[model samples]
Target: MRLSMDLELQDIPGQLLLALQPLKDNKANIISVVHHRERKTPRGTIPVRFVVEMDRSKLDAVKSQLVSLGVTVVRAGEVRFIEDVAVVLVGHILDSDLGDTINRIDSTGYAEVMDLALTMPGVNEPSSAYLRIRATGKAEIHKALSILRQVGEEKKLLVIEPIEDEAA
Candidate 1:
C-alpha cells in the first residue's frame, strides 16, 4: 500500500538517512520525500514527509525501528490520493483567477492539484495551463472534473479532459 509518514528529526547531519533506514531495512519502495530545511518545529526538530509503498505487515516494525533510533513519528497512514488525471485549460487562465479555480476543486477535500504548468504567449493573449489532479477515488476525480468544467464555463476557458482508455 501507499503510505505517507510525517517525521521529526534532529538537525544534525545524517539524521535524514537515519530516519529512512527503517524503510530501507523493511524493503519499502520510496516514492517521494519533502524535507523542510529552514522550518524547525518547537521541539527543535526538522519536519520531513515521506511517501513509500510497503507491505502492511512491515509498517509497525519500521515504526518501532524509527522510534528506537530517536526519530519522532508525527503521523503515518495510507495515502488518499489514489486516482489521478491530467487536464488542460486554454484561455485567460491567469486573468480568470487561476488560484480560485484550483481552490474550488481543492476545497472539496477529496481532490488537489498536484502539478501545474502555465504558458502565456503575450500580454493580452489567452494562456494555457496543464494540471495534474489527484483524488481520493474515481468518484472524487469525476466530481473535481465537473467542478473544473463549471469553472471553465464561468471563466470562458476551454477545459480538456483525458480520453478514457477502453482497455483499462
Candidate 2:
C-alpha cells in the first residue's frame, strides 16, 4: 500500500536522518520526499512530507517506530493529488516531438502529465493526443496550459484547453 506521511522534525543537523530511520527499518520504499526545511510549524519545527510504499501489515509498525524516534507524524494516509486538467492536442502529434511537449509541462514543477491517450492513424497523417495534467493549484493549471500552448505553437500542433464555453 502507498502512504503519504506528513512529519514535523527539528530544524537541526541529523533531524531528517533520525526521522527516516523508522521508514528504513520498516522496509518502506521511499517514492518522493518534499522536505520543507524553510517552513516551520507552530512550535518552530520543520515540516517534511513523504510518499512511501509499504506492505499493509507493516504500516502500523512504521508509524509506531517513527513516533518513538521523536518524529511527529502529522498525517499519514493514501497519497493522492487533487487537481487535474484535461487537454487535447491535434495535428502532427508524433512528428512534432510529443515527448518534449509533455516534458515541457512536467518540468514546470507545479504540474505533471498524469495520464495520456494518443490516436495515430498512419505515419503520414496528423495525430491527436489527450493528456490529463495534475497541478498543484488553479493558477498553476493556467501556467501549465500556457506552457503547452507555447510548445504547441513551436511544434505546429494545436492545443485545446478545457472550458465550458465553446465559442470563447
Candidate 3:
C-alpha cells in the first residue's frame, strides 16, 4: 500500500539519509520527498515529507524504527490521493489569484493540486497553466473541477477540463 510521512529531521549532514533508513529497513520503496528547507519546527529541525509504498505489515515497524532514530514523525498514514485529473487555465492566471484558485479546491479536503506547468508570454500578456489534480475518488474529482470552474468564472479566466474520453 502507498503511505505518506511527515518528519522533522535534525539540520545536519546525512540526516535525510539517516531518516530514510527506516523506510529502507522496512522494505518501503521511496516514491517522492519534499524537503522543506525554509520551514522548521519549534526545535529548529527541518520538515521533510515523504511518499512511499510498502506492505501493510511493515508499516508499524517502519514507524518504530523512525522514532528510534530520533526522527520526529509528524504524521504517517495511507496515501489518499488516488484519482488524477488534468485541467487547463487560460487568461491572466497570475492576476486572477492563482494561489487562491488552487487553495479553494485543496481546502475542500477531497482534492489537491499535485503538479502544475505554467506559461507566460510577456509581462502584460495572458498566461496559462496545466494542472494535475488528485482526489480521493471520481466524485471528488468532479467536485474539484466544479470548484475550479467557479473560481475561473469569478476571476474571468477560462477553464478547460480534460476530455471525457481520457481515462482517469
Candidate 4:
C-alpha cells in the first residue's frame, strides 16, 4: 500500500532523523521524502512529506509510532490533496507578520501552503509574494483563502485572488 504523510517536526538538529525513525522501526519502506527547511507550518514548525510503502495492516502501527515520538501528523489518509490554488499577496509581507498569516491557514488542518515566492524591490518598497496552496477539497480551499483574505485585510496587504484556468 502507498501512504502519504504530512508531519511537523521541530527545527533542531537530528529532529528529521528522529521523525524518520518511526517509519524504520515499523518496517515501512520510504519511497520519497520532500522536506522543506525554508518553509514552515503556521506554528513555526517544519513540514515534512513522506511517501512510504508498507503492508496495509501495518499502517496503523506506523502512525501510532509516529505519534508516540511527538511528531504532529498533519494529514494521513487515502484521499490525496488533488486540488491546487494560487494567490498573490502584494504588500510588506515581511513586516506584516508572514508567519502568523501562514499559521492561520495551516491551523485549519485541511489545507497546506505548499510553495511561496517573494519579490522585494527594496527595503522601502512594498514586497509581493505568490503562494501556492493545496487542499483536499474545494470547501477547504475556500476556507483557507477566506482566512488569508482576512489576514491580508487586517495587515493592509493587497490580496489578488487566483483566476482558475478554464482550459484545465
Candidate number with greatest lDDT: 1
In model 2, what is the error at residue 166, expressed in angstroms? 25
The backbone clash count of each candidate, in order, is 0, 0, 0, 1
lDDT for each of the candidates? 0.87, 0.81, 0.84, 0.80
Clashing pairs in 1: none
Q: What lDDT is obtained when candidate 1 is compared to the true structure?
A: 0.87
What are the per-residue Cα lDDT tens digits for candidate 1 across 5-96?
A: 87999989999999988999999988667677667898899988777889978989999999999999987878668899999999999989
Higher TM-score: candidate 2 or 4? 2
Model 2 RMSD vs true structure: 6.2
Best by TM-score: 2
lDDT of 4 by residue, 16-93 (tens): 898888789778777556676667877888988776777767777777887898888888655367778999999999
Which is better, 2 or 4, measured by lDDT? 2
Q: TM-score of every model?
A: 0.54, 0.62, 0.53, 0.53
* C-alpha RMSD by candidate, in order: 12.9, 6.2, 12.6, 13.2
**Model 3: residues with Cα > 4 Å off, grouped in runs:** 81-86, 89-132, 135-168
| 1-168 per-residue lDDT for model 3 (tens digits) | 777777899999999999988888888888667787877778999988777878888878888898999999988887678789999999999887889999998666657899999999998998999999997556568878999999988998999998876575
Candidate 1 lowest-lDDT run of ten: 135-144
> 1 or 4, which is superior by lDDT?
1
